[model samples]
Target: MNKGYVYFLTNYRRTTIYIGVTNNIHSRVWKHKLGEGSLFTSKYKLTVLIYAEEYDNISDAIAREKQLKNWHKQWKWNLVKQNNPKLEDWYDTLRGW
Candidate 1:
């Protein structure tokens, strides 16, 4: 099975959060940072990587992404706070991988 990743992204204002699933978190997040990921992300400026999870299978990652997308806005933020209380941008962590 291929490895996969699910991640959450937000902007400085934290007004909007974007969730995604990818086989390569580094490349996908890099595209998002460059504003080439999606129309919604670009419009909302959600470039900060705040939360992420890895799965052994792409299907699992996709299912998790679907679940997160269906969650309430506050619920998603709450999840982020659980792991990232400060809600800091974790983009820099992808380096040297």
Candidate 2:
């Protein structure tokens, strides 16, 4: 079975949020960082991976992505804060991959 991921990206300092799902988290994030992803993310400059959840099924990841996208901004903030209180830009972390 293939793995899928539901992830949230934020602008520097967590000013904006974007939720998405992808089978290749690394490549997808790299695209966002390069401003080659969605227009929304590129316009907002939300390239930091603040939170992510892995799923064994693509359907499950898509469902989670939809759920997160529908959440209120405050709710999303709390969710990201729970795991990434500092809201660090994760792009550098993936550089060694």
| Candidate lDDT (C-alpha), each | 0.91, 0.86
Q: Which lDDT value does model 1 have at 19?
A: 92
lDDT of 1 by residue, 23-61 (tens): 999999999999999999999989999999889999999
Among residues 3 or more apart in sequence or in different chains, the pairs in candidate 2 whose N, CA or C atoms overlap within 3 Å are none
Q: Looking at candidate 2, what is the lDDT of residue 20? A: 89
Global lDDT of model 2: 0.86
Q: How many backbone overlaps does candidate 1 show? A: 0
After superposition, the stretches of candidate 2 with alpha carbons farther than 4 Å from their true spots are: 92-97
Tens-digit per-residue lDDT, 1-97, candidate 2: 6788888898886777888899888999999999998999999998889888889989899888888888899999999899888988665675543
**Global lDDT of model 1:** 0.91
